[model samples]
Target: MGIRSVLSKPLAKWVVERQREWMYRPAEAQQRWMQRLIKGGQNTVFGRDHRLTDVRTVEEFRQAVPVRDYEDLKPYIEQILNGDSDVLWKGKPLYLAKTSGTTSGTKYIPITRDSIPNHIDSARDALLNYIHETGNGAFLDGKLIFLSGSPELDQKAGIHVGRLSGIANHHVPGYLRTNQLPSYETNVIDDWETKLERIIDETIDQPMSLISGIPPWVQMYFDRIQERTGKKIKDVFPDFSVFVYGGVNFEPYRAKLFDSIGKRIDSIETYPASEGFIAFQDSQTEEGLLMLLDSGIFFEFIAADEYFSDNPRRLTIDEVELNKNYAVIINNNAGLWGYSIGDTVKFVSRDPYRLLVTGRIKHFISAFGEHVIGEEVEKALTDAMSKHPETEVVEFTVAPMVSPAEGLPYHEWLVEFATPPHNPAQFARDVDTRLTQLNVYYDDLITGSILQPLRLTSLPRGAFQQYMKSLGKLGGQNKVPRLSNDRKIADGLMGVVSGK
Candidate 1:
């Protein structure tokens, strides 16, 4: 074995042991971090304005600061952008993570010096945890490719500004730099198609062992590889054992991805955002991700059902219950106060606070009071596909068709199929049945005849990709929403179909 492979076991063991110190003591670690954040904020403008210095408990902190989205916090962000120090955090932000915003256009999230480790180390810890559990560190000796945004960055107001993936490129540890694939020149290409082609050319001949990206984009890479070499990914890169992915749930794409690889390998799911690295899969046997309690972010939850209600109860870590969906609110060391990143999660195990990302607060279908979520739609489709083993899905989205040319309005499933189902009508009915079982409100609406049974629209290949390209969000952290209450996406898909 190589020196790095031999040493990985001991290093992973040490990291796992240190992690246990904070992982098991959830309440204590959260309380301590909350106090530290409060103390750090006391000297900043945001802290003084919100009376944070006098806050001694989580309750006081909550009372002092209201939960705010990007729009609500823009004034403070504007001040920071104009070269002001101590406006939000204690000092100027180390970097600004630029991400796409639905209503706000582009959002610049502060990455303070104190908060960078949370983003960097959590990813490292996730890999180490996998090694410690499986005793398979040989992948460390081979090439690893992270299919992400360009590493090149621009400066705004003296702070480096770029996508989170790009900013993270500057912090990759020295030890693994040699094994990381795609030369810097290839990484800086702005056009995703060009970048993808370059990446395939660079890595196809290498002894690749690990690959990481959002599922759809990674699927595209795999597809291109097969097209070029007429071989499955496993044949081209036999040592490719670990697949690390994040940004979206992998269930819907799992069957197709595995089929593309032609074998089953270890995969890690991560819950990361521009705001923070919240959770990661710690155990191969576990169903949910282990939430990071001491990652410089103090978390609060509001029940998903009550999220739209006035005076929603924001509960701390100790107050959360298992299997109940709650919108996540975070107060982190990066100067974000009571920030809502729009994700909802459900705890599966409270012993170590492992949770599943249920859905986004705004990404849902409640057109007829049938409030269907991402989790429900994904699970419904997954269950239905289980029976149709020959069918393979490429991409899909759900939107309400309130005013169809014929019949009662219904939920429309726009799917791009790699292999069409043998009985498409039966497949749609199966999916509808599963969805109705998962969501009582949806079931009621269907039974009462308020809405017709859901309809399936088989989209032509690359239809969703064309829609994303039309919106100038073709790649790099952009994902199709699982479902939307409005028909914007449905109409857009129609446009793409007609244009084709």
Candidate 2:
């Protein structure tokens, strides 16, 4: 380990030790602020009539913040866009983080200056937890590859958050900014493809230790490395320590990432968004993710079993149930009083607030916890397909069947062709193998004969994207959604994938 690597643990210890200062200090002070924030959230987010603000104890924080769906936050989002600063954070949000939603349209979430440290802290917790879990303290010394929105700003506000990929160009630390794709405090990605290519080329030669970012783009760069170098990524950047991915599931494609790479490393889940970096994995060996920034943002949990119920109880951080899935609610500094990012997560513990991200409430397969997530399925499918000759896939989506056939509960896939030999049957077998290899539950269900076999289909060029574009969607914040809870989505995908 290098000098920095050896000091990685020390640096993390310093940060966590200082969390009290950045967040809250003194037990009484912490308790006082907690109560105040809870009351503030209940009255401001839940509405003035909510009885939650008056309730004491940590349970109040849980019960007051109802598990909200994304659609419920449109008006609040509009408030942020129009320059109203009355919601979550304390100061003027440094800049907005662009992202996409269930559909193709964009979502512009705010990131206040105070919240940036929280992101760093949450990320640091993840890094430190890895060190503790794997006994690899020098994990950060290796080249850290962050595949994020390009360093090109969309140049307009309210254009939706995903389009704001360029914002990171300015928000990133100054030391790294100079080595960045474009110069400081400036939004410039000279040529989208060329810039991405340059990033891949530059990153390929480095000692990439810890990789972090959105999984899709991570897979994109991995494919590029293989195509340009005529070898699997293991041959190029073999020293990868751990993959730190949030904003998506890593289960579907764990085969391609964990097993496909040359090194054996950990995969840490994070609960970061354009909105805020809320939670992270705290322990290296623990099954659930640790939440470091609970103080950065007030949290709430609603039992999945109670989602549609009239008296569904939304509990606070301390009242969260272990191992069972629940929808999350948040009141952060971004002016989103009580907002739900539409993600479904389950708490593993709360001593430090760790969680397991099950799936998106609206996006997951309700049938048999097929819980088909983007990161997992994406990595799985990509790894499976890469096993073939001279080929790599750019994108894919999985849609579950609405109508079951004779004890079969299959999920149909829509794959975008990257090369020839696109035989649907072979691809199906490949994908099925991936499901069994990477996803434990998927393998169990398949072995137990619970679900139907997976089906594969290729879409015509510009079919689903065109549909998105036609709807005035299609941007960074929004990806072409692959899985759906809505039954109608299957027919739409079937028609698009078949080019019918």
Candidate 3:
């Protein structure tokens, strides 16, 4: 082993032990973070406006500040954008993470000096935890590539402005700098296709050991590699051992990704957003991500079913129940007060507070009052794939067919197959059956003749990619939504159905 690899084992153990201090006492850790955030916000404009100084408990803080989305917090964010200090946090933010917004055109989330560590350290801890558990740190000796956005940043209100991944590039620790791949020049290429080609060129011959990115983009990179060399990713990078991904669920793409790699490898899932790094998978055997209790962010959960209701109950860590979906709300040192990032999660293990990202608050199929979440659809499709091992899915989305020309309106599933199922009709039936079992309301609707069984529309290979390319969202953290309440995506997908 190299010098860094020899040293990594001890460092990984130390880091894992330190994480256990907060992981085991999640409620207490969360309380301390809440106090710290409140103290930091006390002198800021948002804190004063929300009566943060007077807040003594979680309930008091909840009462003082109502849960808000980006639009609700935009006024304070505008002050920061106009070069105002002590507006949200105590001073001007260290960085403004630029992100695409649906209702709002664009959003700039603050990343304060205190909050930046949460992003940087959490990712490090995830890898360290893996090394500690598996006793494999040799990956550190080889090149590690992160498929990310352009690191070249712009300035706004005297604060550096860029994508979250771009901002994170500046914070990669000195120890890993030598091992990180894709030269700065290659990383700064604005066009994803051009950047990807350059990345393949730069690292195609290197001893790549670890690769991290959103799964679809990584899959695309693997596809490009195969196209160039006619070899599996594992053949190209024999030392490759770990895959780190976030921004979307990995299960749907798992079979296809592993097929490209030609083997199963250790993979880590992370729950990160422009606002904060919330959680990361700590154990390979664990079912969910270990929620970061001491990461400068205090979390609250509102039951997903009750999220749209007025006066939704905001429960703290100690009060959350297992296997129940909740919309996550966060108050952090970064100046976000009761901000809703619109993500929904379910606790799989409460002793250590491990959660699965169930879906987005806004991304669901409830056009017929049968609210089907991302988790259910994913599970349904996964179960079907398990039964039919011959099939492999590339990408898919579900939308309500509210007004069909034929019989009863039903749910429409647009699926792009990497390898078509041997028995496509039976595969669709299996998915539909599993979905009904997972969602009772959907079963009831079908039983009552309110809706027909889901209709499968086999999309031409690369159809979804083409759709995203048309919208200028083909790569780098952009992903197709798993499902939508409306047919905006489904209707747009119709144009690409010609080839199939």
Deviation of model 2 at 155, angstroms: 6.7
lDDT of 3 by residue, 1-500 (tens): 98878888999989988988987888899899888888988999888888888999877988898999999999999999888899989989999999998788889999999999999999898898889999888999999999998889999989999999999999999999998989999999888889999999999999999999998899999999999999999999999999999988788889999999999999988988989999999999979999998989999999999999988999999999999999999989888888999999999998788999999999999999999999999999999999989788889999999988889999999999999789999999999999999999999999999999998999987888888877888888898999898999998888756632
User: What TM-score would every model get versus the actual structure?
Assistant: 0.99, 0.71, 0.98
- Sort by TM-score, best first: 1, 3, 2
Segments in model 3 whose C-alpha atoms lie over 4 Å from true places: 497-500
lDDT of 1 by residue, 46-91 (tens): 9999988899987898899998899999999999999999988899
Tens digit of lDDT per residue, candidate 2, span 345-445?
A: 77766555567776666665546776565545665676666666444444567777646756667777766554534466776788788877866777888
Deviation (Å) of 117 in candidate 2: 2.1
Q: What is the lDDT of residue 445 in candidate 1?
A: 90
Top candidate, metric TM-score: 1
Better of 2 and 3 by lDDT: 3
Reference-based TM-score, model 2: 0.71
| Poorest lDDT segment (10 consecutive residues) of candidate 1 | 469-478
How do the candidates rank by lDDT, highest first? 1, 3, 2
